[model samples]
Target: MLLGCLPGLAAVLALALCAGGVERSVAASGRQVVARPAAAHKAVRPHIVPRSVWLDDDTRHAQPPPRYDDRVIAVFVHHTDSPNGYDCADAPRIIRYLYAGQTGSRDWDDIGYNFLVDRCGTIYEGRAGGIDRPVTGAHTQGFNHRTTGIAALGTFTAGVPVPKEMTDAIAALAAWKLGLSGTDPRARVRLTSSNSHSRYAAGASTTFPALAGHKDGYMTSCPGAALSALLPGIRETAARLQGRH
Candidate 1:
């Protein structure tokens, strides 16, 4: 009788690792106990167009396999630095152009950004890796690992009228990506710099907003002034999406 009870006890202990809620029987107390895992604070993943939509085999470059980190704790926003007055229907061509420039002239393994958002609010996967995975990007100089890079499809210099649709999509993507690691969009996270080209020296540790601009980690005007000004509101929106206050 004792040996049989031991196996039942072990099964009940394993319930703690399960996500959501689980119930266990308490024979001694003649009551049921509920065991729930800690809340993940995850948000529903926003729709993202796959890389194949932009980079076909004809245009695809032969690059090494993608690299990854444990999880994404932050997001670095950027702009493609191209003209903004483009038809949303032409977004795929624009992305392909950017990909050519990066992999051809810049000699990067792949497109730097992990994701890109068009002015019409369409989100597209930029890099080769899975969007749900923490694929290290080349968007930020030193803080690429453990962070996601989201590029606005066009330039957003000061006084530019950033599209509300675009910003909304960015917020949703950020919320989902950051939530995967239980990171709050409005909070700060500590990260180590891997390159001296960044604002922080190599090996330096610093704290930055979980949702931040490219300038936050590197010395650049990327994600531009107009977009940078919207970051606070974006953070709030992202947090709300994640079910955070």
Candidate 2:
């Protein structure tokens, strides 16, 4: 009897280990069932360098408390329109320069973009808000609310080679951020225009790609033709990263 009981005990231990340490219980039918762990629906957040890496106390501007929305349903992609030949080592310096220009010349309270990606595929936290929150950015004039802005570090005009690393980083960032709200990157989201300056008049309801170029909501040829052409692929990649079939 002891030897038979030892075999049964070994089998029960194996089942527990295979079930990932979850508890097992008997079902109404009298069959033992293993309770598996719940599946994770959210994507893993990608690595992002904090604003302090680039902005120190001396350069930090005095801005109002970061504004937030209910959730981030869309993302706007943009190009800095700056030089593309910058070394990755100088990315922090370049970001600082852009911050100064936006705050000094443009008179903006802080950097407009919620995040920035360099040519070397490094992601940097922009603005003065928490990256995980749906911070209202100033990148898109009419659709700033309920959206996040990601600016590619350099210019990407027609015929220019958009770095693969940069695009991959953007996709990863989008997958995680949009995944927070269970948003599909390939889906079209309806956004109400807050400013009349956009392509759509103020208060107009329009549908745009969840992952869109800055030009989609605005009149400017922002993000340039080269990067604009890559939006579709980026959307698909982001969806895949989020485990969408």
Q: Pick the candidate with the highest TM-score.
A: 1
* Per-candidate TM-score against the hidden true structure: 0.85, 0.83
Best by lDDT: 1
Question: Which portions of model 1 miss their true places by more than 4 Å?
Answer: 1-37
The lDDT of each candidate is 0.81, 0.80
Q: Candidate 1, residues 1-245: lDDT per residue as tens digits?
A: 00000111222122110002334545687666656555777889999999898888887999999999999999988877667799999999888877776676556678878999999999999988898899988778778889988988777778999999999999999999999888989999999998687788889999999999988876567677899999999999999999987
lDDT of 2 by residue, 1-245 (tens): 00000112123211110001245566899886868654433578999999999997777778889889999989999887777888998998887877776676556788888999999999999987898899988888788888888988777878989999999999999999988877889998889999687788889999999999988887667788899999999999999998986
Candidate 2 displacement at residue 1 in angstroms: 80
Q: Which pairs, if any, clash in model 2? A: none
Least accurate stretch of 10 residues (summed lDDT) in model 2? 1-10
